[model samples]
Target: MSCSGCSNAVNRVLQKKEGVTSVDIDLEKQSVLVKTDDAVSYDDVLATIAKTGKKVNGGQVIA
Candidate 1:
Protein backbone atom coordinates (compact mmCIF):
# COMPACT_ATOMS: atom_id res chain seq x y z
CA MET A 1 0.00 0.00 0.00
CA SER A 2 1.14 3.54 -0.79
CA CYS A 3 -0.30 5.37 2.21
CA SER A 4 -1.35 4.87 5.80
CA GLY A 5 -4.99 4.89 4.82
CA CYS A 6 -4.41 1.89 2.60
CA SER A 7 -2.68 0.09 5.40
CA ASN A 8 -5.40 1.01 7.85
CA ALA A 9 -8.07 -0.20 5.49
CA VAL A 10 -6.30 -3.53 5.15
CA ASN A 11 -5.82 -3.72 8.90
CA ARG A 12 -9.51 -3.12 9.54
CA VAL A 13 -10.66 -5.69 7.06
CA LEU A 14 -8.34 -8.44 8.27
CA GLN A 15 -8.95 -7.70 11.95
CA LYS A 16 -12.60 -8.54 11.47
CA LYS A 17 -11.89 -12.07 10.38
CA GLU A 18 -12.48 -14.98 12.75
CA GLY A 19 -8.98 -16.29 13.28
CA VAL A 20 -6.90 -13.25 12.49
CA THR A 21 -5.18 -12.38 15.73
CA SER A 22 -3.05 -9.59 14.30
CA VAL A 23 -2.12 -7.77 11.10
CA ASP A 24 1.07 -5.93 10.31
CA ILE A 25 1.37 -3.81 7.22
CA ASP A 26 4.71 -2.88 5.70
CA LEU A 27 4.05 0.18 3.58
CA GLU A 28 7.54 0.33 2.10
CA LYS A 29 7.32 -3.27 0.96
CA GLN A 30 3.59 -3.02 0.25
CA SER A 31 3.04 -6.23 2.13
CA VAL A 32 0.66 -7.40 4.81
CA LEU A 33 1.61 -9.88 7.48
CA VAL A 34 -1.36 -11.62 8.99
CA LYS A 35 -1.20 -13.80 12.05
CA THR A 36 -3.97 -16.33 12.09
CA ASP A 37 -5.01 -19.46 13.88
CA ASP A 38 -5.96 -22.88 12.61
CA ALA A 39 -9.60 -21.96 12.24
CA VAL A 40 -8.83 -19.48 9.50
CA SER A 41 -8.65 -20.67 5.94
CA TYR A 42 -6.29 -19.23 3.36
CA ASP A 43 -9.17 -18.84 0.95
CA ASP A 44 -11.07 -16.77 3.47
CA VAL A 45 -8.10 -14.49 3.92
CA LEU A 46 -7.67 -14.11 0.19
CA ALA A 47 -11.37 -13.31 -0.23
CA THR A 48 -11.24 -10.80 2.61
CA ILE A 49 -8.34 -8.96 0.98
CA ALA A 50 -10.09 -9.14 -2.34
CA LYS A 51 -12.94 -7.11 -0.86
CA THR A 52 -10.49 -4.26 -0.36
CA GLY A 53 -10.15 -4.05 -4.16
CA LYS A 54 -6.42 -4.59 -4.03
CA LYS A 55 -4.54 -6.89 -6.30
CA VAL A 56 -2.82 -9.69 -4.38
CA ASN A 57 0.53 -10.55 -5.91
CA GLY A 58 0.63 -13.89 -4.10
CA GLY A 59 0.54 -15.43 -0.62
CA GLN A 60 1.56 -18.54 1.22
CA VAL A 61 1.17 -19.88 4.73
CA ILE A 62 4.31 -19.84 6.80
CA ALA A 63 4.88 -22.72 9.14
Candidate 2:
Protein backbone atom coordinates (compact mmCIF):
# COMPACT_ATOMS: atom_id res chain seq x y z
CA MET A 1 0.00 0.00 0.00
CA SER A 2 3.05 2.27 0.22
CA CYS A 3 3.10 2.39 -3.53
CA SER A 4 0.92 5.13 -4.96
CA GLY A 5 0.07 3.06 -8.02
CA CYS A 6 -1.21 0.20 -5.92
CA SER A 7 -3.13 2.55 -3.68
CA ASN A 8 -4.82 4.30 -6.60
CA ALA A 9 -5.67 1.01 -8.24
CA VAL A 10 -7.20 -0.37 -5.09
CA ASN A 11 -9.00 2.91 -4.48
CA ARG A 12 -10.55 2.74 -7.92
CA VAL A 13 -11.80 -0.79 -7.37
CA LEU A 14 -13.38 0.12 -4.04
CA GLN A 15 -15.01 3.13 -5.61
CA LYS A 16 -16.95 0.83 -7.91
CA LYS A 17 -18.64 -1.13 -5.15
CA GLU A 18 -22.10 -0.22 -3.98
CA GLY A 19 -22.76 0.92 -0.40
CA VAL A 20 -19.36 2.55 -0.34
CA THR A 21 -20.29 6.12 0.39
CA SER A 22 -16.75 7.33 -0.02
CA VAL A 23 -13.10 6.34 0.42
CA ASP A 24 -9.83 7.97 1.38
CA ILE A 25 -6.83 6.01 0.23
CA ASP A 26 -3.60 6.96 1.95
CA LEU A 27 -0.41 5.40 0.75
CA GLU A 28 1.60 6.98 3.54
CA LYS A 29 -0.68 5.52 6.16
CA GLN A 30 -1.06 2.23 4.39
CA SER A 31 -4.74 2.33 4.94
CA VAL A 32 -8.02 3.06 3.21
CA LEU A 33 -10.64 5.08 5.06
CA VAL A 34 -13.93 3.78 3.76
CA LYS A 35 -17.32 5.16 4.54
CA THR A 36 -19.76 2.46 3.66
CA ASP A 37 -22.95 0.81 4.80
CA ASP A 38 -23.56 -2.41 6.71
CA ALA A 39 -23.99 -4.10 3.35
CA VAL A 40 -20.32 -3.53 2.74
CA SER A 41 -18.95 -6.63 4.36
CA TYR A 42 -15.34 -7.58 4.85
CA ASP A 43 -15.70 -10.10 2.06
CA ASP A 44 -16.86 -7.36 -0.26
CA VAL A 45 -13.83 -5.29 0.57
CA LEU A 46 -11.45 -8.21 0.22
CA ALA A 47 -12.87 -9.06 -3.15
CA THR A 48 -12.38 -5.50 -4.26
CA ILE A 49 -8.77 -5.49 -3.10
CA ALA A 50 -8.20 -8.86 -4.66
CA LYS A 51 -8.88 -7.34 -8.03
CA THR A 52 -5.63 -5.43 -7.57
CA GLY A 53 -3.62 -8.35 -6.15
CA LYS A 54 -4.04 -6.82 -2.70
CA LYS A 55 -5.93 -8.10 0.31
CA VAL A 56 -8.37 -6.69 2.84
CA ASN A 57 -9.23 -7.70 6.37
CA GLY A 58 -12.02 -6.98 8.80
CA GLY A 59 -9.88 -4.83 11.08
CA GLN A 60 -8.78 -2.70 8.18
CA VAL A 61 -12.35 -1.49 7.50
CA ILE A 62 -12.47 1.26 10.16
CA ALA A 63 -16.11 0.18 10.69
Candidate 3:
Protein backbone atom coordinates (compact mmCIF):
# COMPACT_ATOMS: atom_id res chain seq x y z
CA MET A 1 0.00 0.00 0.00
CA SER A 2 1.19 3.49 -0.85
CA CYS A 3 -0.83 5.77 1.39
CA SER A 4 -3.69 6.01 3.85
CA GLY A 5 -6.12 5.66 0.98
CA CYS A 6 -4.52 2.45 -0.09
CA SER A 7 -4.54 1.09 3.44
CA ASN A 8 -8.16 2.16 3.84
CA ALA A 9 -9.11 0.36 0.69
CA VAL A 10 -7.55 -2.83 2.00
CA ASN A 11 -9.17 -2.33 5.37
CA ARG A 12 -12.57 -1.74 3.83
CA VAL A 13 -12.40 -4.75 1.56
CA LEU A 14 -11.02 -7.22 4.07
CA GLN A 15 -13.44 -6.15 6.79
CA LYS A 16 -16.36 -7.17 4.55
CA LYS A 17 -15.18 -10.76 4.24
CA GLU A 18 -17.05 -13.59 6.04
CA GLY A 19 -14.59 -14.31 8.84
CA VAL A 20 -12.34 -11.26 8.98
CA THR A 21 -12.44 -9.98 12.55
CA SER A 22 -10.04 -7.08 12.03
CA VAL A 23 -7.58 -5.56 9.55
CA ASP A 24 -4.43 -3.57 10.19
CA ILE A 25 -2.49 -2.12 7.31
CA ASP A 26 1.09 -1.05 7.75
CA LEU A 27 1.73 1.37 4.94
CA GLU A 28 5.42 1.58 5.68
CA LYS A 29 5.85 -2.15 5.36
CA GLN A 30 3.33 -2.36 2.54
CA SER A 31 1.57 -5.17 4.36
CA VAL A 32 -1.85 -5.98 5.69
CA LEU A 33 -2.35 -7.84 8.94
CA VAL A 34 -5.71 -9.53 8.99
CA LYS A 35 -7.30 -11.20 11.98
CA THR A 36 -9.81 -13.94 11.36
CA ASP A 37 -11.64 -16.79 12.99
CA ASP A 38 -11.01 -20.43 12.10
CA ALA A 39 -13.84 -20.21 9.59
CA VAL A 40 -11.69 -18.09 7.28
CA SER A 41 -9.29 -19.44 4.73
CA TYR A 42 -6.09 -17.93 3.32
CA ASP A 43 -7.49 -18.07 -0.21
CA ASP A 44 -10.57 -16.15 0.89
CA VAL A 45 -8.39 -13.44 2.39
CA LEU A 46 -6.22 -13.31 -0.71
CA ALA A 47 -9.31 -13.03 -2.90
CA THR A 48 -10.59 -10.17 -0.81
CA ILE A 49 -7.28 -8.35 -1.18
CA ALA A 50 -7.31 -9.04 -4.87
CA LYS A 51 -10.69 -7.34 -5.11
CA THR A 52 -9.09 -4.13 -3.95
CA GLY A 53 -6.83 -4.23 -7.01
CA LYS A 54 -3.69 -3.76 -4.94
CA LYS A 55 -0.70 -5.88 -5.78
CA VAL A 56 0.39 -8.07 -2.89
CA ASN A 57 4.17 -8.24 -2.95
CA GLY A 58 4.26 -10.83 -0.17
CA GLY A 59 2.39 -12.24 2.83
CA GLN A 60 2.50 -14.80 5.64
CA VAL A 61 0.40 -16.14 8.53
CA ILE A 62 1.68 -15.45 12.05
CA ALA A 63 0.15 -18.58 13.51
Q: Compare the candidates by TM-score and give the number of the best one.
A: 1
Error of model 1, residue 29, in angstroms:
0.5
* Tens-digit lDDT string for candidate 1 (1-63): 789988888888999998999998999999998989999988899899988888789999997
Worst-scoring 10-residue span by lDDT in model 2: 54-63
Residue 61 in candidate 2 has what lDDT?
Answer: 48
Those runs of model 2 whose alpha carbons end farther than 4 Å from true positions after fitting are: 57-63
The alpha-carbon deviation from the true structure for residue 57 of candidate 1, after best TM-score superposition, in angstroms, is 0.3
Give per-residue lDDT, candidate 1, residue 63: 73
**Tens digit per residue, CA lDDT, model 3, 1-63:** 788988888898888888899887778878788999998888888888999898877777777
For model 3, the local distance difference test gives 0.85
Candidate ranking (TM-score, best to worst): 1, 3, 2
Q: Which stretches of candidate 3 lie over 4 Å from their true place?
A: none
Q: Where is the poorest 10-residue window by lDDT in model 1?
A: 1-10
lDDT of all the models against the reference?
0.89, 0.80, 0.85
> What's the alpha carbon RMSD for model 1?
0.8
